[model samples]
Target: MGESVLLTSTPPEHKESVIVSSAPQSRPWDVHRLPSAEGRNFLVTGGNAGIGYFTAEQLAATGALVVIGSRNPAKADAALASIRSRVPGARVRHLHLDLADLSTLKSAVDGLALDLGRLDAVVHNAGGALDDPPRRETEDGHELMFGTNHLGHYALTRWLAPLLSAAPAGRVVTVGSFAARSERLDLDDLQSTRDYRPKRTYGRSKLAQMCFGFELDRRLRAAGSTVLSAVAHPGGALDSLTPPRPPVGAPTPGERLRGLPAALMVQGKDAGAWPVVRAVLDSDVQGGQLWGPRVFGLRGQPRREPVPAHMADPAVAARLWAASAELTGTTDPHLGFR
Candidate 1:
C-alpha cells in the first residue's frame, strides 16, 4: 500500500543532518529546563493521545495554560486527568475539535474564543492516512487523510491567526510525517480524483502538510508578523493513519514476531513527543527549526533535523498555499505575500 518514490527530499550533502550538531543518539528534551511556559496559552490539536497528549501534558507541567483540542470530549477529559495526576497543578483544559469537520471545529471559536486573549502557540498534531481501502470522504466530502490532515488544520489556524499574532511570541508548529519523503504534489489529483490509492494519497497529503506549514512561516515573516511557524516531522510516529482497521483481533505468535521491523523504525509515542516540545518551548530554538529524531528520526531520540527537499521546494509550497486558501476559503491574512 505504498507509492513509488519521488525525488529524494534530502539533499546529497545533508542527507542525514542533525540540527544540534554535537548531540548523539539520545538527545531527549528535558522538561525540567523548559522555560516559563507559565502565563502563556497554547493549543494542541488531536491533543488527546499519543504525541498530542504527551505534548500537552509536558507543556502544562511547565505551567502553561493548555487547551487540548480533541475531536472527542471524553478522550480529552481522560487525557487531562492523566496529566493532572502526574503534574500537580498542571493547567489544562479540553474542548471539542474534529479535524474532519470544519464547521464543528469553528464553532468552538465562538463558544470558547481565545480571541479575547493572546495565544502563545498551537501544535497542528492531528493527521492520518485514511485514504486506504474504499475511497471515502470526510463529513465535508473531501478525501479523508488530505482533508483532515491538511485542510482542516489550514482553516483552523487561519481563523486563529489573530490570537496567535497578538501573543507576545507565538509559535505554530505543524506536525508532519516522514512519509512525506516519498510524496509529491499531484495538482491533477489534489483530491485523489483520477485514481485513489490509500498509501500514495497519505504520503502526498503529509507532503502537502509540510509545504503548507513552511509557506505559512514564509508568509508570516514577510508580513513581519511576530508569529513563528515551525514545522516538525514525527519521523516514524506510526499509528493508523491511512487504512481502516481490520477488526481488533489476536495476532499470531509469528505475526507478532514480525512487529520488530516497525519497532526498529518507530519509537513509543512518549519518546517521540520531544521534538514538538523542543520546537515549541526551547527558547534557543529559532524560527523554522525542524525537529525530530537524530537517528533516522522515526524510531530514535529527538533532535532538530533537516527539512526534506520536496517539503522545502518553494514552487510546490507556493502552489499548495494558494490551493489551500481556495479549498479552505481562508485568505490567511497572516500569510506574507511578496
Candidate 2:
C-alpha cells in the first residue's frame, strides 16, 4: 500500500458554497437527521433494490426529489411505492436505465434532463456480480461486471455532467467495495479477457470504478468546477440483517435469526447505506476522500478513511480514465467537466 492523500479541510474559498448540511459539525454526523434537500434532485442507479433502494429512501426523506434508475419497470414501481409508503409525500420517480447497454444511456439521460432540468447528485450504487460463470459479457462486448459496474456508470456520469454542473453544488458519489482493498488493476486486461474469475474480476471492476471516482475529482478540481466526486463503500451489508420492505425484500424470520450472529461482524444493507448517504449529504466531505464504516471498517457510523494505497494512485487512475474515455466514446471535450 502507498501513502493515501489527506485533505480533510475544506478550502477557504469553497467553505460557504460546498457546505450542504445546516447542522453544526461539533459532533458526529447523525444519519437519521439529514439537512433538508427540498428543491434538490438526485438520481440513484439500481435504486430498485439493495443498498441503492435505502440510499434513495434516505435522500427522499430529506425532501429531495429522488429518481430511482432501474432497468426493470416493475421493480422501479415497487421501490417507488415503498418509499412513498415510508416517507409520506416523498418526491420520487423512476428513470429506465440499463447500464449493461451503452446505446440506451443517452436517451435515458435526455429524459432525465427533460423531467428535472438539473441534477444535484447521482449515486453510482448499481452493480452486478456473477456467482459462477463460464464467462459473461455485456451487450456492448465488455465483461459483465466491468461493463455494468464501472464503464456503465462512467458513461452515465459523462452524460449527466452538464446537469450536475448546473446545480449550486453537484456531486457524483461512486459506491465502491471493501473487496477492492486487495485487488490491483491489470489495465491492459480491464475486461478480464485473459483471466476471468468471478470474485477477482468483480473486485477488479470495482477498483476501476473507484479509480474513476478519484480521477474525476482531480479533473473537476483542475477545471475549477464545483462538481465534487467522492467514493464510499458499505462495509458488509447482508440481506438477512436488512429490514424488510414489502415487494422489495422480506427475509424470513428464521433468516433474521440466523443472521443475528453475523451482526457482530456485519450489518444490514440499510446501515451500510449510511456512509454513501453521508458522502452525498455531509457538507464537510471533500472530493477524493474515501468514506466507510467507522467500526473496524465493517459496521458502524460513517467516517472518512484514507484512500487505500492502490486506490489512490494517480497514475493508475489517469490510465484507467483514458481507457474509459476511449471505451465509452467520451473523448469529446464537453462530455464530463463542462
Candidate 3:
C-alpha cells in the first residue's frame, strides 16, 4: 500500500500530460504551527464526538468558521460549547444532518448554503459502526453502515459541489479508515444482504468510501474543476488515550491508566485528527493521494502512503460511483464533476 501510482485514465477532453508530484514534503508538516484559516469556512460531519469532535476543535482554533453537522442538537451544542471553552472566541455552529435519511439532505444543504453562503472544505468524518446486530438498514432501505458511511457522503458531496467549486481552492477530504485496508468491496451486494458480519460489513462500507474519494479526484481532474479530493485515515485512535473534553469525552483516571501501555501502539483521537487536519490545511497535498500515520500504519504523525490496491482500482471506483448515484438518486448528469 506504500506504492504511488495514478489511479485513472486521462479524460479525452484533455490531451495534456498530467504529472503528479510526490507526497513527501521538503520539511515535515508541523501540526502545532498550522497556517491560519481565517475567513475560510469548513464543515465537519459527525463533529459532536470522537475524532470528529477533535477535528472540529482543532480547525476552530485556526480561526476558521467551522460548522459541526450532527443529528443530535444537544450534542452539537455541547461540542460547540466545549470548543469555545477550550479556544476562547472560537466561531463554531451546528447544522442538523442525518445521513441515514437521504430525503432530508436537500434541506440540510439548503440550510448550510443559506447560513454560510460559501464553503471552502468539507470533511466527511462522521461514520456509524454496528458491532453486533441482526443487521440494520437506513430509512432509505440501504445497509445502515454503507448508507450512512458512503452513500450519505456521496449525496452530500454532490449538493456541496457548487459551494466547494466557488472557493478559490475548494477541497473535499474523505476521512476513511485503516479498517478499509484489509477489506475488499462486494459491489454486487454492497449492502451485505447475502453475507453480513458486523465488522466485515463495516469495513466494506469504508472501503466504498475510500474508492469514492479517489474516483472523485479522477472526475474532478477530468472536468477541470478546482475542487480537490483527498483521502485520509486516522490510525488506531482509542478513547482511553484521548484527552478529556468536558461533556463530550471524559475518560476516567483508571481508563487513562489502563490505556498507558497501549499508547505505544495506538494514539488519542486528538492525535488521530492529524492526518485529516493535514489533508485539509497542508498546501502541498494533491488529489487522489492516500495519507495515514507514519508508524506501522497504526500510530504516529501523518504522512502520505500509497493507495491500497483494492481502494485504488479505477474499474471498481467507477462502478461504485454508478451504483451510488443510482442508490442515492443523485443522477444529475453534471452533479459531481461540474
What are the per-residue Cα lDDT tens digits for candidate 1 across 1-338?
01221212424443221122212325445533444555778899988877787678667755678888887777787788766655556678886888888777667755556434767899999876563488888888889889999999888887677678778888889888778887789976789988888999998887788888887887778788888888887666544321111121234556545655677667555556768887887766767668887777775656778777878888887778788788777675464222
Q: Against the correct fold, how does model 3 do in TM-score?
A: 0.91
Report the lDDT tens digits of candidate 2 across residue range 1-338.
01111212435532211123445656678776667677889999999999999999888777788999999999999999987776656789999999999999999999999888899999999999888977798899989999999999999998899899999999999999989998999988988989889999999989999988888888888888989999999999999999888799989999999999999999999889999989988888899989999998899889999888899898998888888889888885335675
Q: Output the better candidate (1/3) by lDDT.
A: 3
After superposing candidate 2 on the true structure, give the runs of residues whose Cα lies further than 4 Å from its correct spot.
Answer: 1-27
Best-fitting candidate, measured by TM-score?
A: 2
Residue clash pairs of candidate 2: none
Of 1 and 2, the candidate ranking higher by lDDT = 2
lDDT of each: 0.72, 0.87, 0.86
In what order do the candidates fall by TM-score, top score first?
Answer: 2, 3, 1
Top lDDT hit: 2
Greater TM-score among 1 and 3 belongs to 3
Report how far off residue 240 is in candidate 1 (Å).
Answer: 13
Q: List the candidates' TM-scores in order.
A: 0.81, 0.92, 0.91
Q: Order of candidates by lDDT, top first?
A: 2, 3, 1
TM-score of 2: 0.92
